[model samples]
Target: MASQQTVFMNHGQGETSYARNSSIQNADQERMKPMIEAAIAELCTANNGLSRGNIVIADLGCSSGPNALTLVSFAVEAIHKHYLELQQPPPELCVLLNDLPDNDFNTVVKNLTTLRRSDEPVVVTGVTPGSFYERLFTAESLHLACSSNSLHWLSKAPEDLTRNQIPAYDIDEHARRERLPLVVEAYANQFKKDFTLFLKLRAKESVPGGKIVVSLLGRRSEGISSKFPRLVEILLQILSVTASEGVFEKKKLNSFYVPVYEPSDEELREIIQEEGSFWINEMCVHGLTSGMDSALITPNRLANQMRAVFEPLVAQHLGDVMDEFVRTAEQRWSLEGSLQDEVARLATVAVSLTKA
Candidate 1:
């Protein structure tokens, strides 16, 4: 597996920048508000009468954008509401916004200071730049940790996938679907390893009885025919067209891989149990429809949304051809049939766990 070094969100302000195209992710984060509240409440209650003076919370893979600060705001407000319900003074908050080193931490903090609610407890936000697969905090320092739409990212691409010049989710290109079981297994096993290490690290950093909430894009189906993977197929076709043109080397696409895997519900449960650091308190899969409305699914918007996420990775490999590739994707999407009458459902798995 190739270790990921710069898997951060798109930066700056533009139509394709993460700031503008992250509505889907923001909606997903909003969907996690209740889960965050519940987790914080559990953390507060588990402390009994202990003062808990300073509450430590980490938002792992906290990308830089509006949605990132929105997550912090939700957590702060959740903790405030919990303290209010308990008729206790709110504890000082120590929030660690974590992501890859390439993330725009300055923008994250600036946005945090802007979006922070005045009524929320005093929060001292810090930037933790590193991979979540590694330990970032001291032992027993954290009270609650939450991640949204992030855990699906693997620490590295599967070695076999890279070796075979197969992108992680490109199961439909070049007769790759015929090798579905092997490819999916490789991705799943990689996720299991990364997620297991994640659990173990968080377990050590978290105080006994601490809480963690994680929400990730995943699949209910065991096969590669899911909507997300199918979407990647469309993207692959678009890339293939770009490759057909002399714009870039065709072999580059073969070598490029996105270090991400969307696991199934059963796979997640199995890994959590195998990790054995935390007990699952609540686990559920939620469906998300793009902001194009349940009745309207425009591919242009969807493609741009996907592009915003993947442009950084693609640019790293494709370099100057990145713009042409994105344009080709947009054109391909614009020619697609109207899906307005269809309701496209995407799965997101939310799990809340407590330290054992």
Candidate 2:
């Protein structure tokens, strides 16, 4: 099958910029490192002299430049530490950075240039590149694949919940629920296809029993019922109210939510099992607290962060009215009684899967 491809707004905040500049600094990497190291250690133990040769790693959805660099550096350090324990020479490393074509390729190139300046002999390849859901690299060419905080985006908006089918702004519970299945189906289908392709590609490219570590936003429910956590529901409420006020256009709102399918751990496990190329080695759910506590912090800061994350979608649909929409949304939240609880740190779930 020809690899499917689509283009969306760049969301210019590159991976590195988003990670470094966000309120949550290294929070993602810190949570993921131990899991990654353990997986690598296990892989080395299974295969004698696996750490002795060139080791190839790929970071899927390696947004912008700095984000990829951060992951590559972490992987390299981890591998080197393992080599020390094994009393073997450090493996030559090849790190492939992959992302959508519209991503900040220039920034990634620049950041990697600086890394090359170091004395260490690192072969960094920039695969400027393609979607992770589609084929982006050769078969059986990778030792490990790592993707963080990016899988939530499906290749396209779900077909059933497209702009035309979405209910009017004042949609009630029944109508929302009725539409919810289609929305979930769209996300689920696309994710299944994309992830299946990812697993197949990884299996062909990676050596036997290579490791794949992915950290993404996950929820504990498969349906759109009240089963979702309170915090996510609150965020949805804020989004709905703002969207109804025409701050975010109806189409953008639908597109934005279409791919936000956070599967429960059991649901995720089932998906992996069906794919048949990976084994669920380890998994954990870590709350992604944004750390915006402190009573002195202003509402504007919170608003700005929300805007930064969603502005691309808003601008795409709302045209010139995007800023006005955001302002009105902020006003609504303020009137609803300052979002004190909403200010608490958000949580994210991470999982590590290995080749079967």
TM-score of each: 0.88, 0.79
- Model 1 Cα RMSD, 1 decimal: 3.1
Put down candidate 1 lDDT per residue, 10-103, tens digits, no spaces: 7876777888777777777888888888887777777622355888888898887787776667778887877788888888888888998888
Least accurate 10 contiguous residues by lDDT in model 2: 1-10
User: Which stretches in model 1 have alpha-carbon errors above 4 Å?
Assistant: 48-50, 115-121, 163-175, 222-231, 290-292, 295-297, 335-345
Q: What local lDDT does model 2 show for residue 97?
A: 86
lDDT by residue (56-108, candidate 2, tens digit) is 78888776534566666677778778878888766677778888887667767
CA lDDT of 167 in candidate 2?
35
Each prediction's Cα lDDT score? 0.75, 0.61
Worst-scoring 10-residue span by lDDT in model 1: 336-345
In TM-score terms, candidate 2 sits at 0.79
